[model samples]
Target: MFEKILPFTRKKHVAGLKCAFTGHRPQNLPFRFDETDERCLRLKAELRKLIVQMIEQKNVTHFISGMALGIDTYAAEIVLDLKSQFPFITLECAIPCETQAAKWSERYRNRYFGIVEQCDKETILQRHYSSDCMQKRNRYMVEHADLILAVWDGKPSGTGMTVTYARSLRKSVWTLDPNTFSVTVE
Candidate 1:
């Protein structure tokens, strides 16, 4: 699927390394639903802390995301917030296909489009949408990233596919296991 996008060149570029994030659209609270306000606050706090650690430890100056409903959107929002402090933190929107945002609800579409507008780069995988196109997009993301941050619920889905591809590439992969409250890399 990704026969075109070349991997990052090793020429001594002054910019920081690029890190992409791929994960399932989290259906749990603070993502899809709002349970207790306190829990929501706590979860947000933890997420921010983790994101900060990734930026500091991984030297991630750029974040690439697909703008999906749950995990992708959350990661993008965190990157946007971190941009204020780390102004060089770039957000790149890697859409599976043109008009892919149309598949989402109107509100979500608007929000996602707004984020794309704020991004430093936006790449469309195909001129049209297809079931297989998302897999192609995921492959493209894994190909370009120095590291991948995956927020997973242990489901076998697109996130799993992305993780598999990243592993095959031998890229640094960090996973936030919501079940264990820990990060692990294979």
Candidate 2:
């Protein structure tokens, strides 16, 4: 149902090295929307470390986030925070639909908008949501990116599916398990 994609940022030459994010939502995370929890804080720390590693070592200049809750939100924020240090890096919000956060709580909605406003690029994949819109957005990110960064619990969920899809395309996939704080590359 995606007829057109819209970008809200001024045009710039796309970067050569890019990374895309796929992850579970808040409900599936151990902290369950409680960012103050020690577990959540630790997870964010690890996530930030991984992103920095990607930027510093791999020369990844572009990061794409699905703009979902939980890990996606964390990734976008981490990218923004690192911008002062790595001014060449850019964050792209690969939103699945125009109203992706319409049903979210007011707190989350505000957070989403704040991140979107600060992002270097905002890509709305579709004007309206569809049954497969999320998957469509995931594929869009994987297709555009050179590497896929995933936060998955090894379950048959959306994040798992995105990892599988990335592998099938022979894209480099790095997975970080939020539960054990372990990372695997494939």
The clash numbers for all candidates, in the given order, read: 0, 0
Tell me the tens digit of each residue's lDDT in model 2 across 1-186.
333233445445445589999999989988898999998999899899999999888899999999999899999999999987877788889989998999998999999999988887788898898999999999999998999999998988999999999999999999999899899988
lDDT of 1 by residue, 46-165 (tens): 667777887787677878898887678878888888877877677888888877878678888888988887777788888888889888888888988888888776678788888988
**CA error at residue 163 for candidate 1, angstroms:** 0.6
Top model number, lDDT = 2
Q: Give candidate 1 regions above 4 Å deviation.
A: 1-13, 28-31, 35-43
**Looking at model 2, which ten-residue stretch has the lowest summed lDDT?**
1-10
Model 1 accuracy (lDDT, Cα): 0.75
List the candidates' TM-scores in order: 0.84, 0.92
In model 2, how many backbone clashes occur?
A: 0
TM-score of 1: 0.84
